[model samples]
Target: MPIDMSVWQGRSDPEDGNKGLRWHQKVQPADNANESGIMLLGFACDEGVSRNKGRTGAYDAPVAIRRALANLAWHHEAPVYDGGNISCDDSNLELAQYRLAEDVSRALRQRHKVIVFGGGHEVAWGSFQGIGNYLVQKQHVAGNANEAQQPPRVGIINFDAHFDLRNPPGGKQSEKGSSGTPFHQAARFCELHNWPFKYVCLGLARTSNTQALYEKADRLGVLYKDDHELVHHKMEQTLTELQRFIDQCDYLYLTIDLDVFPASVAPGVSAPAARGVPFDIVEMLLEPILKARTPKGEPKILVADLAEYNPRFDIDNQTARLAARLAWTIARAIR
Candidate 1:
C-alpha cells in the first residue's frame, strides 16, 4: 500500500480565519496519487526529555495543534500534506523519530514544504536535514560558480530563549534528546554535512544560555539576534539585519520554539524568557519575513516547526490559537 496522508478538515480551503470551522478527521490522498505544493508533514516528538519522562503526552502535541489549526483553515489554498506521526515508544525511539526525520528529508527533496508539530524542539534536527538537503543538492548542481554559489541563499531562523549550541557539554549524552539541545545538534549536523548555512536566532535570552555557546556561535559565524539587542536598537535596524540573513538562503526554514515568547503571550512554553520580545517587536521584526516573496512570486519561507507547547501550563489553549493566527501570517507569506 502507498503512503496516504491524514488531512483533517482545514476549512476545505483557507478562508476568513474559519473560527467557526468544525474539524473532522480525514485521511489524505483520498486516493493514491501524488498531490503537490506545501505539504504539512505533521510529526510529533516524545523523546526530548519531558518534565515528566514517564508520561508520553508531549507526543500528543501534533494531534492537538493539528486539531486547532484545522478549525482555523485560514490558508484555504495552501497545499497541506499531513504525513502523520511516528509512534514514540521505547524500542523504536530512535527509529520512530529517525523515520520521521527521514520522511521529512525525502519530502523536502521533492520540494514539498513542511510544518512539524511537536513533542519537543528536538525535531528541528529532522526538519533541518530535510531543508538542508534541498539546498546542498542545488549547491552541488550549481558547482562552484561564485555567482552560482549565490543562488538565493537558504537560511534557518530560530526563535528561542537559549542559544542551544552546547557541544554535548564535555560529551555528555542526553540519554535521549533534550529540549535544550536541538539547535546545538542542528548547527553541528549541518557542519558535518559540509553545508555552510545562514542562521538568525531571534529572541534568544541570555539567562538561559551559556557564555561558551555565544563564543561557539560567533566562531561559527551564526547571527544571534537576541531580544535585548533588538529592543535597545531601532526596530528597523533589527529588521534590516534579518533581511541580510534572508539574503543568503534560497530555501528558508523558520523554527519558532514557543520558549522564545514571553510568559505573557505564550506561557505554555517550558522555558519562557524573563524578558519577552514584546509582542509588537516580534510582529514588526517578522513583518518583512512574512512579506517575503518566493521565486514564483509567492512567499519565500516554506517549512516551519513550532515546539514546546505544554497545554497543562497553558491558559485556555491561547497559545495554540495564537499560533494558528501566526501560521496564517506565514501561509500568507507563501501566497
Candidate 2:
C-alpha cells in the first residue's frame, strides 16, 4: 500500500514560474491537526471490467490520474495524503475490494476528506461501503438520531454513461459483482444495513444501456436523467432537481465515471460516450453540491471517487488530464 512516488515530477521554476511548482510539490501526508485534510486512495483493480465484458486497462488509472494532477497548481491549503493503493489480482479481487473499504473507513475516522481514484466503476461499491460505515458509526455515537428522529440519509450522485445497475452475474449462484453491478450491489448493501438507497444518476446514454437495465433501474427506484435531457436550457432544472435530492440526505457520495464525457474528451475509458455531457455542464451540477453543508454545517460530500479512466486508449493524455482537473476541482472546493 505505497503510492509510486515516481509520478510526482513536473515543471518547477519558482522565479519565472507560470509553469511553476505543481501538486506533487505541495501534497503531503494528511497528518495536520489545525487544518482539514484530503486523502488520495488509489484503487488499482480492473477484474470487474472483465466480468462486465468491457475493455481492460482501467487498472492503470490511479497512477495516470495522479501523474496528471501532479502538474496542477496547488490552490488549497489542506494537507493531502497518499493512501497508496489497493491492487487486485484475478484471484483476489474480493479481498482487494474489502481492504479498500477498511482503508476508506479509517480515513473517514481520521477526519480526512476521502477522494478515491479508481480502476473501474466497481470502485463505487467499496467507496460506498466505507462512507456508509462511517455514517453508521457517527449515528451510533450521537445516540442513533440526528435531531430528525431518524438516522441520517445518505445519497449517491453518479455521473456516468450507464446506470451500472446490472444484477449479480447469473442471478444467484455466481454472486460475484462487476463494474456494471456496483450500484446494484450498493443498493443491496444499503438494504442490509437498513440504510435508504437514494441514488441519483446523471449523464446516462440511452444507447449505451439496454431495456433490461432501464427496467432494473426503475425497480430499484433510481432517479436518473438521460444524456439528451442535459441541454443548455435544462441545466438549471437539473441543478434544481439535484438540490432537491441533496436536501434529503445527511451525507452524500459523488462518483464520476470518465466515460460520461464525449469520446473526444475522454476516449480512454472502458466505454466511451458517443455524445456525452460536456465537462462544464458536469461542473455546474457538481460545484454547488461540493460546496453544500449538512444541517450541522459539515461538508455533505463525505467521500467521492473518479472511475473509468483508461490510460491505454487515451490520445495525448486527454482523458487523464480531464480526470485530474476534476480531482483538482474537488480538492480545492472541499474545506
lDDT of 1 by residue, 1-335 (tens): 34333435554543624443333322243133175555555556556645223233456667667666766634345455566666566644456557767767676666666677776666676677666665666667777655445443557788877765665434534434455566666666665665665678888878777788888789878888777876845776877788877765666778877767778888766665678677677777777776676667756776777777766566888777766666556655654
Q: Once superposed on the true structure, which residue ranges of model 1 sit more than 4 Å away at CA?
A: 1-33, 51-57, 73-75, 91-93, 136-153, 169-177, 293-299
lDDT of each: 0.64, 0.86
Q: Per-residue alpha-carbon lDDT of model 2 for 1-335, expressed as tens digits?
A: 44567777787868946346579887764443345589999999899898888999999999999999998887776788787888897547677778888889999998889999999998998998888777778778786544555756888999999999888877823447889988887888787777788999999999989999899889878889998898889988888888989988888899999998999999999998999999888988897789889778888988989999999999999999999999999988876
User: Deviation in angstroms for 7 in model 2?
Assistant: 1.5
Minimum summed lDDT over a 10-residue window in model 2 is located at 27-36
Prediction 2 global C-alpha lDDT: 0.86
Best lDDT among the predictions, by candidate number: 2
Candidate 2 ranges beyond 4 A from true positions: 16-20, 29-35, 144-149, 170-175
